[model samples]
Target: MLSIEGLRVEVEGKEILKGLDLEVNAGEVHAIMGPNGSGKSTLAHVLAGREGYQISGGKLRYLGLDLQELEIEERAHAGIFLAMQYPVELPGVNNMIFLREALNAIRRARGEPEIDALGFMKQVRDKARELNLDEKLLKRSVNAGFSGGEKKRNEVLQMAMLAPKLAILDETDSGLDIDALRIVADGVNLLRSPERALILVTHYQRLLDYIQPDRVHVLAAGRIVRSGGRELALELEEKGYGWLSEEAAA
Candidate 1:
């Protein structure tokens, strides 16, 4: 569903993604594993059309569209979702209200009719149940006073509701206990379909143990240094990223 070639991104005066290339197809889950500062989050941000990162060179085509030409909202409307590393707190905003508006806005952009209030609530409730999120949290302010696990669960709930064609989850498993991690992973796994694709950007192999990604790519110094199957995550867990970084530098 997505294709990238020789993608280079620069922040400030330095480059973070250097000649990176990646392709994701429908129905496949790809895990991006890397050490700190290896540009995993950068890739997520760039794919979501976040500002400040200059694409100096490369071709990024999403479903045959010129991805770089689309704005952030356009990307979302076009079925691209990014589950942030740190979900933002929208104080004074009702969680359900905020999500409904966002979902309706995307629907509007796509020339679809807005769902009625009752229908929207049913949708949200269904997705929340899928993620094992409490219905009470939907009535509260978005991410306000939420625990770390709550925030991540909220992200997965959004993913389930949105059902994006390409979902980029940046460190969604970070800061979660084992139980919370399992819940989130189960929610993600349930969403896997032949028409959808997922990109999981993470640091540890623990998350992979639950998600069982179809492919694993080790990113270092802004490039995918190695690509392998699910066993690669196990190898990385056993040997650590230090060995991969050395191999990349060599």
Candidate 2:
């Protein structure tokens, strides 16, 4: 469903992603494990169409459309979802209002009519219940006064509502207890389908325990160095990324 070829990206005149190539087919989940500064988050930002990341070279195709040609909103409307690692706080925007606006924006982009307030509220309630999120959270400001776990849950709620064809989660398992992680994982697992693909960017293998991936890749220095099955994750957890880096250098 998604294909990238020889993608090289740079930010602030510094190259981050160098000759990165990946392909994710429908009904598959791929995990990208890498150490810090390995361009994992950079790949997510570039795919999301965030500004300031200069595409030095290569191509990104999403379901046959040229991803690099689309804007961030366009990507979102095209059924591409990104769960950010750090969700920003919007003090003035009520969570419900923000979500409604986002949903409407996406709907409008797809030539769909805007949903009424009541209908939107019902959808929010239903999604929140499915994700194990509290209804009160919808009434509060976006990420304002929310705990770390709450922020992560809010991200998952957005994913559930958006129902993207390809979901790219950047460190969704960070800063969460086991219980919170399970809830977040459940939200992701529920979204899996034959027509959808998932790319999980993580540092540890703990999150893999909840949501098993079809393939595991170890990325180092902006490139994939090792591709293996689920067992590779366990080995990395036991031995650490240093060995992988050395292997990549070799």
Candidate 3:
């Protein structure tokens, strides 16, 4: 579903991604594990085509199209959904309004008719209930005055509604307690299907316990140095990144 080769990116005149290569197939869940400053988030940002990150060299393709040629919203409309580590709060923009507009925007881009307000609300409300989100939460402005857990749950809610082909989650488990984590995980699991893929970037193995990614990757010094199965996450958690980085250097 996604292919990246020699993906090098620089930010603020400093190189972050040296030469990262990764591929995520359809119906697969890939986890990227790295310590701080390993460029995990950088890869996510570049993939989504965020502004200001210079692509010094590399090729990224999604569904066989050159991803570098697409705009941020274009990438999103093409089924790339990024659940940010920090959910931005949009004051004065009601959550339901934001969701409807987003859904309609994607629909318009696809040349499909926009869903009526009633239908969109029903879909959002049903998914929110299944995700165990409070209906009131959906009525509030996007991430406005929300707790950490609330923000994360909101991100998952958007994902559930959007149903992107490739969902990139950057540290979705960063601030959640066990209960909130499970709530978020349940939403993610519900969204999993044979047609879509998930890329989970995390530092710990606990989230992997519930999700059980098909593949795990260790990124160091702005590149993916090691790739393995589920056990790799366990090994990294037990031994720490130093061991993995040394192994990569060797």
**Local distance difference test scores for all models:** 0.94, 0.93, 0.92
Estimate TM-scores for all models.
0.98, 0.97, 0.98
For model 1, residues 1-250, the per-residue Cα lDDT tens digits are 8999999999996899999999899999999999999999999999999999999999999999999999999999999999999999999999998888888998999999998899999989988988889999999999999999999999999888777999999999999999999999999999899999999999999999899899999999989999999999999999999998998899
Selected candidate, larger TM-score, 1 vs 2? 1
Model 1 compared with the native: what TM-score?
0.98
Model 1 — which ten-residue stretch has the worst lDDT?
A: 155-164
Q: Residue-wise lDDT of candidate 3 within 134-224, one digit each (tens)?
A: 8998988899999999999889999989889999999999989999999899889888899999999998889998887999999998899
Candidate No. with top lDDT:
1
User: If the candidates were sorted by their lDDT against the true structure, best first, what order would they fall in?
Assistant: 1, 2, 3
Greater lDDT among 1 and 3 belongs to 1
Q: What's the lDDT for candidate 3?
A: 0.92
Judged by whole-model lDDT over C-alpha atoms, candidate 2 comes out at: 0.93
Task: Put down candidate 2 lDDT per residue, 1-250, tens digits, no spaces.
Answer: 8999999999999998889999899999999999999999999889899999999999999989999889899999999999999999999899988888898999999999999999988988998998788899999999999888999999999988878899999999999999999999999999899999999999999999999999999889988888988999999999999998998788
lDDT, candidate 2, residue 193? 95
Off by over 4 Å in 3: none
- Pairwise lDDT winner, candidates 1 and 2: 1
